[model samples]
Target: MNSIVNKSLRRLYLLGKTVRWGMRPCPAGARETRLIAGAQRSGTNLVMDILERSWEADVYHESDPRAFQVYRMRPLPIIQELRKRSRAKCFILKALCESQDLPELMEQLAPAKAVWVLRNYNDVVNSMVISFPRTHEDLQRIAQDRKLGGWRTEGMSEQTYRLVSGLVKRHGDALTNASASALQWYFRNVLYFEKGFYQHPDIKLLRYEDLVTQPQRTVSGLFEFFGLPYHPWVHGMVFSSSLRKRPAPELLPEVAELCEKLWQRFQELEKPQSI
Candidate 1:
């Protein structure tokens, strides 16, 4: 199929870029490690793809085995070694799964900075239900505290766990995939507030809507945060077609109310630094 061929060609092109960038001479002085963190389906991929197009930075996607294992980021020591070896001035890494540990990770990887992206709950839930059919089932276990072992439940504050558990108890198995995915969004994103990220100077907040609608301004602000100069190649890599493209899914009344409150909170917190 043409789609498959196109995907293959894209991978080859990216590989060529990575290989060529890796061989460049290391710039003088220390290299800054930049991290991209967010909940799944929250435009992290788009951001990473655009960043990868930059010749001044070296990217280590979560799928990169050198920095990740089974899509989760590898240990800090391994990441440090990779940072040390990269020749670029900025060593960029994507760590969505390890978002909960970012505060500590940033401390350990000092001279590091991060961007935590936020997206609309309705859109994120829509994408989750379609891309991950088993999400509802997985979240049921997470809500009931039956599966505390997975990354979904990791670093979950007791207060957050109780809130999600109570919601599941109220609706029982009657909860729809949309609502479940929304709760997943809540639990993961609430960590931004619960972990005191609002006070963290090195971690910046970015909105998915802003990045898509105003790509140049938003990304220029992001690059400024990372202390990297913006390049023109990233312009063609982002488009606004995905903005509010999907119909909002049917969510339970309680879940909808909960997500709206959290969404409003993010809006308030993100106002001052709007690009």
Candidate 2:
């Protein structure tokens, strides 16, 4: 009877602590007013790095617990704190699309502008497969790291590899399968010519190809879009930055054909007239 009572008391105490922490106000100078969202491996990191170097933009590379907790207390309250901290007009929040808490974040940053970056779907998938292997052995390794049962131990099949491969073969499938991963990239670009929030007037859409092919023009346009002074040095810096390293794999003829088709589709989607 004493043990049961003590357990109940402990639960109550933890609940109270959680509520208290949740209600605490976020510290001054810690919310982001600007944001960058995109699929993984889509140059979001590079863009953030360049923006920080050129514009003196305050960018948080990952989600901050304090900021998140504060955001939970009140939407946009963090923005005020960020403004106070940086004493800059813009604060950039960089987060993986699928991982962000959308409704809450959107509520807080309703009027904020966003930058969405996209890469060819085949490239994105190929990169993921290389970096995050889906083989049973790889899954087992991941599970061990995560303190979960290994795939073999858990009696899970090795079908994850096939499933991931199939999904990557479909263009824009990342946005659909991992919506937050590629949400802004897929959705906003698709609706760029349209009006309203779906089209997001303040959002700027950029392609990884353009960044690679014409760094100067692309960075210049980005700075201008954000109302920041265009720095000549930024062009060179962005170009010289290390590209994401990927092992070269001889593409199957079919995959190569698919990549070409998707690349063409991307070109069609990015025509200036389309926007």
- TM-scores of all predicted structures: 0.91, 0.53
- Position 79, candidate 1: lDDT: 86
- What's the lDDT of the predicted structure labeled candidate 2? 0.49
C-alpha lDDT of residue 84 in model 1: 74
The lDDT for every candidate, in the order shown, is: 0.83, 0.49
Candidate 2, residue 39: CA error in Å?
A: 0.5
TM accuracy, model 1: 0.91
Lowest lDDT sum, 10 consecutive residues, model 2, at: 175-184
Q: Name model 2 segments beyond 4 Å from true.
A: 1-32, 63-80, 98-107, 135-198, 240-265, 270-275
How would you encode candidate 1's per-residue C-alpha lDDT over 54-109 as one tens digit per residue?
76778888888999999898878888888877777788889788999997887777
**How displaced is residue 80 in candidate 1, in Å?**
1.7
Please give, for residues 1-275, the per-residue lDDT of candidate 2 as tens digits: 99899668646754553454346533434333556655566777778767765433555565455444432222357655654555333566764432223334555654355666767654555455545443333333333342342211221223422332343444322222222222212322232232222244565567776787788888888776665567767555466333444433344444445445544655765344221
Where's the lowest-lDDT run of ten residues in candidate 1? Answer: 266-275
